[model samples]
Target: AIRCTPPDALRALTRRQVDTAELYYIRGDVEKACELAAAAWPEPAGAEPPVRRRALALYTHTLLYTQGPAAAQKLVDDTLAQAADDPWLRSLALAFAADFNSAGDRPYARRIAVEAIKICDELGDRADPIAAAVAPMALAEIDMFGGRGLDRSLIERARAAQSGQSWIPFIDRAEVHLGLSAKHVDDLGTSQAILTRTLRQAQDVGESSAMLILQAHLAYTELLSGRPEAARAALAAFDAAAREAGPGIGEPGSLTVSRALLAIMDDDLDRAEAILLAALERLPPIPIVRVVMDTPLGAIALLRGDVERAITLLAGVLEQARAVHVNEPSVRGRPEGDLGQALVTAGRLTEAAGVADELAEIGARLERPTLTGIALRVRGLIATARGELDEAEKLLGAAAQAHAASPMPVERGRSLLALGQVQRRRKAKTEARRTLQEALDCFTAHGHRPLARLAEAELARGQRAGAGSVLTASEQRVADLVADGFTNREVAARLSMSVRTVESHVASVFRKLQVRSRTELAARFKQ
Candidate 1:
């Protein structure tokens, strides 16, 4: 067995270690990758250079992704100094450099990524195929989308470069494969099909440790894609797997998110808010969680009609999204779409138009049907608020048409109600009645009685205004609350509504009773 060694004998240990590090990296186990790779560096005098360079590269990559740029910068600077002549090592370090500045300097990240790609190209097809694959894979995530987000060609290149390469293992390929799959992960049918395959593949290969996290991801995907039953089942499976693996296992952060989404589905905002805030505190505010959880916390505020607070919450999430290179659409879509809605509700029409323009830019870049519909709906609201009836009708018509195809009924129902409001405002009584009736039908079909009543009141000459006796049930409650001298935020808390919506209801109370101040309303109620 010790008769003779191969020409690449010196590469044996470091090469195998790099392969194992890639496995940990793919599993989201950054610490393990760092641990394995940190020991492979400081290459011995006569060792093959690629093995030593790869270990240094992986150590930097893992450290950057997990601990962030500040923590890894010194190590990267030191290693690159030693391996300055190595094209493969330099390409990886530059890509990690792009990621390092991703939050602080996006323009710089693009510049660095371009340089990294050129270095990889210099290595060519015959030399350092793994770097050839990884440079583009890393670059694809950081490059400017020309407002179109990631280019398909770059993703294909990353996938293609990995072909016929023995340096990267099959297990390490899962992350790359799943990165592509996460695009369709917001749709039920497609998500389930793709996730099932991913889960099965992990299982077939006995990679159960990776499956623990994958199961939670599939569950979260199910929660978003409109399959609560399937989500519930996936969660159960995840719990079982997590328990079987013992304590401190899998990513429970996504589980917390799934629970919050479930609460949202049940119309339990109070519960959803509590869970979201708790998780936001407990988990690191990573890009994926910000997209999935933090944005929803703002949605809860918006649901309560707390438009100002919603804006504050969503603005922070959007800021992070712009800084980080999270190419997932769902991650970016929520804050952009809902921030516009919040502005519209706060009667900030000009600002709402700005938000709408931002969303339209996203829609143009992403070309997603749901986001495009929301942009249209928000634009229609801006038009309607400005009394541009004809333009509002055109925009609203397109919005309704787009929403009609959405998996989420709330979207379609919202567009219908908005259209009805425009019709009523235009004094198109017959059209208003039909449109409002359709809106009512939609809400009722979805078992949304409270929303249906809002539509019914719209059809009744806006009876929520002008007289206490004529006040709709909601308006009556708002009137009593106003009489009690409660502030908008307090009343919102009491009624599980937003402060802005409460302000609107209070304004209606003042109009109906012809009262100017809270004191006046309170005295009238005293009678």
Candidate 2:
């Protein structure tokens, strides 16, 4: 379906029935698409390079969705053997085949995609859209996996060939839609619409495997939109469809992971945890599984007040995610947010602030509203811990607004609670009380008892009976400066206080904050 002539236009040519079939296939008509392809060159025994490669591409794609990676790999290997001179086909086969594997294998997929891109770049725009599509799909996956470097140009160029409309472009476009939806929770409606349309088109064409994959994503998007019931329904539909399609319809680890995620959303923590552990047992080693599973597990644990356990798991997963470059635009920024919470629990305020900054950057780049809100909430916590009450209040308020705009239930609840805590600390008693009550309502609505209890505590804090306020304004200011990597002399010079006075303030701030060492003080700032 590369940027070639339309099927009808190509039908006018005497020996291009295969081309016409390819056109139909690219447009989402897999059966008719395959038929056209078969009719174009009745036999591959004595076919030329174009017909052989075309047939191999069609058959390979068919096997991928219907059989499994092994079958598809055989076809790909045979095609490569036959088309040894063609780097383009080889690249496509390599990348497309890797899609059936884990995210740990993403680097392999990315490599193939890059190879395709390199070939295309060398060939110039004269290259067909068929070859062009592979590069962008690869880049998108790479960006989604790595959490950085989304090449919009590659995506746009790959889709430039409407005349050669085929299932590949549609599949690639659907992938983009899912990726964008996962990354950006701000506009759930638009993203969901795109996924819906893509799934429909894939189904209409007998692309059952593609349809199943899209269905999983659709369910994920629904869950992200704060509709766990809808997500459950969608997952059921996907499971049913996959089962009807028989074995090999769904990839090995994919459906399993989706089910686990759904379980987490349902608050079936035991089931969710078991599912993840089982997945780890069966699936190939991959950073995505660890990162994805740990984030939710940590969230669930945190909600359950298993703070120390949550911190340990999340911190470990965050390191794994970073090791594998999992912060990409398509994967969502949940890992960083999860890690920030872990840091907060451990009272590593400065570290948590850095993680929050990372989350903010990820959200902005990916257009993710929910993630941005969570990052803002964490920033508010960091600010409050550092005694910047006004800034903390402002950030917390922004978090509330951002959460309100998205459909992520957990994030919304957390934002509300964090905002309430900041407001209470700022001495806005009535507002704090109201906000904490609202947060409690949200947590209760979601059936999150632990979070509801925490919110209640914040509400009580708004009317606290503390015997003393330990850190004075000057001391807090000096603490903030020191935590920001400023020396005592620098803090004194900037604040117009003597070095000795600055040191005295720092010591008092440390005692009042119940921390020891500059590292601990820095950690508080991050929280």
Candidate 3:
């Protein structure tokens, strides 16, 4: 109909094309939507202000997913230049800029979002409704991405502006931001409830895109709240829904991170590695996505007993996260703690000490018990490595106590395990057994198989004789070789013994050292 219309009548038909493009976007046909939106106003400078604004909004949004952020950013820049005198169009352009920048340049995003809101405020009753609604939402999104506590005033303003707009996408986005803000504050219960409820609303309205993103958010919240089974279920549901919806409907980075975390919990390190590596190839160069994905890869390296590799991976992630000012406890905290552990394992105590201090400062600044607990645990590990058993015991105990204030079962279990090891080293047999049992119960209930196995080994060690009394010189040699990544056959060859004899010695060393696997053996050797 547009092409058949007279050239002079084309202006009247443009709104129809923009509306159709929006419908396409809502229906998940993003490429088609981009095509239509782009066709509607090929030259923004020549089109009417209102038509150009609508075309730019739809085109840039669709372009973001189809052609990447750079293309969308270019369009937004052009629109901003063209709309300098038009407060409404300028505010919308700023809002778009703020939303995309939240993924990368968070501080800048926050600044511009505030500026957009100021423009709307000055315009007052004359401000465009969409611009008014989106400006505050963009600021709230930047706050969410930065892991700063959400400003309820901004959220309320966005919600109020959205009233009577009938813009389903922005409405759903506001709700998601609210849900994730609860998560940022570690209010997992509220986050889960809001996300679940919002997801149902989206589903009821056939909002497929919102539903997929909400599923990812809910799964991440479940994982953090120590409900791995529920997290797994949510992820499975997301995958099934995405498959049915074809493609371009889900948030790839978030879904990838969540799935990789689940795999890590299940001890499927290879699967997690593959998932993250694949995502690295295809995922955009967004700072937050890179940080989240690489942190888990560092964890996988750490789990494999590659101390140097883990240190290198985690250190890079920590540096990038700091560069972006990623103060979120989960994003920066996890990698920082892991890097400290890796440094300690690699015998870099000074660097590990610096990491511990940084964590403590971050914890105090954020007022998050979880970060405080992690800092204590890292400090305790450093103390243990330095052979200060009393300090290790004290720190680990405090770490466990700090974690008890939060609902982080995995972190609490880790502190208990570390404390039990310190107690055993101090020859507090009864206390060590009790602590180990508690750690075991926590890991078992959370289905953390890897950590549960470590706790079980610690318990078994408490039941046996001391390491010095049980292991002979030959067994010690075999143990040292195995912990150094030498196979039993290689150890036997190096020691001029039979493979069977080496195997027997290895078993004795494992029993005496109270370790269940080579990774544990390596950790014991490092300590």
Candidate 4:
């Protein structure tokens, strides 16, 4: 119909093309939608402003999903240059800011978002409803990536405004933000409920882009809520959708992190590291992504007993996180705790103590249970290193209590592990067994294999500490050889025992002796 129209009637025909493109977009035919939207654009200079603006907005938005943010950059820049004061153009600017954000140009994104908000304020009653709704949402998103706490009121206001407009897609966008905010505040249940319901709505309308984004968010929320199986299913669905949508539909940062975490849960450190490294290469230098990815990488190093590498990775992550102003527990606090643990493992007690102090201060100031619990766990580890067994026990027990009200079972399990170890050191055999059992149960239930192994090792030590002696006869023989500087394999050869049994006995001996290293064990034996 458009091609058959007379040359003089092309302007109206172009507008009709944009309307048809919007219908295509609504029906999830994104490639067809984008082609039509792009064709409707570059309208004649004398064309209707509303028609041009609508075409530009649809074209840029659809292009983001079809060809990524870079493809839309020129159009957004050229449109804004000509109509900086246009309300619909201002709204388009807000949407473009969000694209820049996802592309990792946070400062530029923030500037555009703030300017759009100011323009919306000036337009007041005359402002486009979409612009009015998106301006605050865009700014809030930037702030969140900057490590600033989410301004949930902005999301609420956007939702209220969008609701009045009766635009289902716009309302779904607001709900996505709200769901993410809930996740940030540790409200896992609320986050899951909102994302799940909104995702269903998006699917119902064939809102393909919205559905993909929501699925990514839901995957991460499920991971955080200790539902790795659910997270895996959601992420798989997201990947399937993106594949069907074609090559240019890229994975979101949240989905990348979720995949890495699932790998970590499966005890596949190599796979997790590979996932994170790939993300760093392909994704923009988004600070939150860096923090999240590197922290886990550091933890994998620590799990592998590469103390120096863990410290290096974790220290850099913490420094990057500190540059951001907000004290978001998951971003800053988790890295702090990880770095502290690495420092302690390296026998850098003084530096570990300093990290503990800073973490405790942040936890106290924020009054968040997760942060407080992490701080206490770190402090407890430091105390154990210093051989303050009773203090370590108290701190770790308190840390477990702090995490009890929180949804993160993994953290609570960590506290219990520390408490159990401290109890073993203090000769509280029954208590140690009970605490270690609970820690093992928590880790096993949550599918945290690496942590569960640590609990198992602790339980093994507790069993050897049965009856009167802290070590069994076999463990005593292993400790004697270890104190004489014999390696596990060497000791196993001498004792005619398997290397695995020798290793287990060696670990039990170290815990029973309250020593951090072989040298410390040698000294204790000499005394």
In TM-score terms, which candidate is top?
3
> What tens-digit string does per-residue lDDT give for candidate 2 at 1-527?
42454544433331365566555554444556555554543354445655555665576665554554677667666666765676656655655554543245567667666766776677675554555665565566566567654555655665663246544545556345344434343556766787788778777766665667777777767766656667777788887777776654334344565576667655576888787788777654656666666666776665444556666877777687767666652353366665665566456788888878877897788666777888898887767656788998898889888888777676788877777766655667788788889989887776455466566655543443221256664665566667766677545433434557777888887778788898988776665
lDDT of 1: 0.66
Work out the TM-score per prediction. 0.75, 0.68, 0.85, 0.81
Q: Write the per-residue lDDT of candidate 1 for residues 50-164, one digit (tens) a residue.
A: 6676676678766765676776887867756866787677777776676556544567777877887788776677446555555565555555322345554765776677677
| Predicted structure 2: lDDT | 0.63
User: Scored by Cα lDDT, where does model 4 land?
Assistant: 0.74
Candidate 4 residues lying further than 4 Å off, grouped into runs, are 1-7, 23-35, 44-51, 63-76, 84-88, 91-95, 102-112, 166-172, 243-248, 278-289, 321-333, 353-366, 465-527
| Model 2 per-residue lDDT at 192 | 78
Q: Rank the candidates by TM-score, best first.
A: 3, 4, 1, 2
TM-score, model 2 to reference: 0.68
Local distance difference test scores for all models: 0.66, 0.63, 0.77, 0.74
Worst ten in a row by lDDT for model 3: 489-498
Superior candidate under TM-score, 2 versus 4: 4
Give the total clashing residue pairs for model 3: 0
Q: Which stretches of candidate 1 lie above 4 Å from their native place?
A: 1-33, 44-47, 61-68, 96-105, 144-146, 166-193, 246-256, 285-293, 323-329, 387-390, 404-410, 423-527
Q: 1-527, model 3: which lDDT tens digit per residue?
A: 65666656566667778878877776677898899999886754446766777787778778987888888889888878877888988898888888777777788888888888899899998776667767787777666556565677787787777676655472336666688677766577888998999888877777666678788888888888889999999988898778877876556576788788888888888999999999988776776677888888988877666666777888888778878867665744378767777777666788988888877886777677878898898899889878888998999999999999876778899889889878876879899899999999999998787678667766764554334566774675567667667676545433334557788988878777778999998787666
RMSD of each: 6.2, 11.2, 6.0, 6.5
